[model samples]
Target: MNITLPGKAATLMASQRERAEKQRARLGVEARSWYRISNAASDDEAEVMIYDEVGGWFGCTADDMIAELRQITAPRMRVRINSPGGSVFEGIAIANALRAHPASVTVQVDAVAASIASVIAMAGDRIEMAPNSMLMIHDASGLCMGNAADMEEMAELLDLISDNIADAYAARAGGTREQWRERMRAETWYLPEDAVENGLADEAVQAPKAGNAPPAPEEDDEPDMARAWDLAAYGYQGPRRDEPKTEEQQPLTINIGAAVGEDFVEQLRALVRQEVKDRTVAPASDATPTGPVAETEPVEPAPEPAAVPEPEVPAAEPVDAWAADIAGLLTTPADDWAADLTHLIGPDTSSRAAAEA
Candidate 1:
């Protein structure tokens, strides 16, 4: 098959292939067995495990999976997957084979079913996810190593593959293909509950507990499984097993006008005015000047200026206009106001003169 891969995926494949080749150089044919099959002898059901990358130079190929699948005469099959997915064409081929099989196939997402592995998931007669498992879907992507024409062709091919994948999702989930396509473009990830809610899985089942299991498997005894895989290579960095799910918090809002009543505002203003008046009436400081103390005697206070005649009062304005004027006057800082009361009152010269004195 013609090989096309995402840049990082291709790099990973190359590294694994090199390691596999080296192992084969020393271990001979034993190193090439990349897939696992169990319970094939049972007539009722058989198990197939796809716990690694899909078709590649070193990993399990579609032909190998199909060849083994054909040998299983069981009427029911269980395909367990915990894969990061591999070649899109290979995944499609495997999905097709499972769909065409005479046995009823049930797919269990043991840990994760991401990328093209999710496509293979659609072939199941019934899909189930463990409570903490996840399934992800995204637009098909691959690297093109040729000229402009070749790049364009590759882009077109990717589009076609995405559409086909979308169809597969829609067929199982009962949504319009365009709706699924939009989600795929955004690279949607689904927890078990979300998968069931979206109709992608029949149900989320409890994880099976092994009888007589060891206290904990040794770290070096098994390869780094699901959680250890670098899913960031495919732009997925979401919740995983044994991690807490954080919920988004709503922003806090305060309504000052509602919290402070008009009566409180009036009381506050009165307090401020009394405070200002006390500060103004206090005697000036008796401390000597910082630069130099003048020896001259203090001059007598100048006689009070002759009282000016009050201006003629204008006719009363509209209530709104009067309110607006009062509001504008209130905006001035209390500290900026002069001690003169006449500027704020109607013809009350006696009170103003008394205040000035």
Candidate 2:
């Protein structure tokens, strides 16, 4: 039977590397910390990280970072540091690995260590902070979210975090737990003297004065690129946006209102069609007539009353009647009569038989 041992080994190695990378991401954030490391030393007994400046993704030198760490063969680990802190959790992870080592660990700082760098400096058998340098410690922070229960749970998580950081400070520093809490609350910065007096730095070194002639530039000193993000708080809400969230891309209120109006109009039209269909589709139970059709002729039995009758009054005789009585003697009746003149005397009416010829 043939066994694919090499492939299996390769797969396992791949998985392990992937897990390491994932683990490294947990503490590296602007809202949190991202520690970069130059090298790590681990043997059967101990693990160590040597840091100059900061390490992790956003903080320090990355070239040969893994190789430098893996090269060490000491059973008891040593971490050499010179830094101004960049990422806190990355430093913590580095510290943790050393703690995990079976043998005691030692930290040797050539220069200054501040912020999280100070925290790392403390994770040692006897922290040997140079007198000319400093050690600074602050708070442990992370960003998270949830509902009621989730919020309480997150709160608990934060408490645990604060406890861990405080515990580290309390263990390594020459101060009470209350004093550590108060100092962190104030966001205090420490100088070399204060660091030493406070037990943050265990020793001192002499830094040379400036003004000596500088060395010539190296023939091969290409600038190293950086994996970078700005740090402002303990943690942030979510992943970093590559591009800014500009107003130009966001929908305006007017557009949102117009969309809602269009939806309402469509709904109204649909409702109208539905109602018309319902009206047209009458049920069999409603098909029967309610009554016979009513006659449309007007009712005329009560006719309007005749014009109001006037009160009785006598009529007066015409003035021409007397004249007609006198003219009757002189005139003979004619088949055709004309009133062209004053009759009884005028030739037009004077005895029409005489005038007729």
Tens digits of per-residue lDDT for model 2, 261-303: 5433333333333334555686778566777989898866987
Per-residue lDDT for 192-223 in model 1, tens only? 99999999999899866869776776877776
Clashing pairs in 1: none
| Candidate 2 lDDT score at position 256 | 29
* Candidate 2 lDDT (Cα, 0 to 1): 0.53
RMSD of 2: 36.4
Give the top-scoring candidate (lDDT): 1
lDDT of each: 0.75, 0.53
- Residue-pair clashes per prediction, in order, are 0, 17
Candidate 1 backbone clash number: 0
Q: Ten consecutive residues with minimal summed lDDT in candidate 2? A: 338-347
Highest-scoring model, TM-score: 1
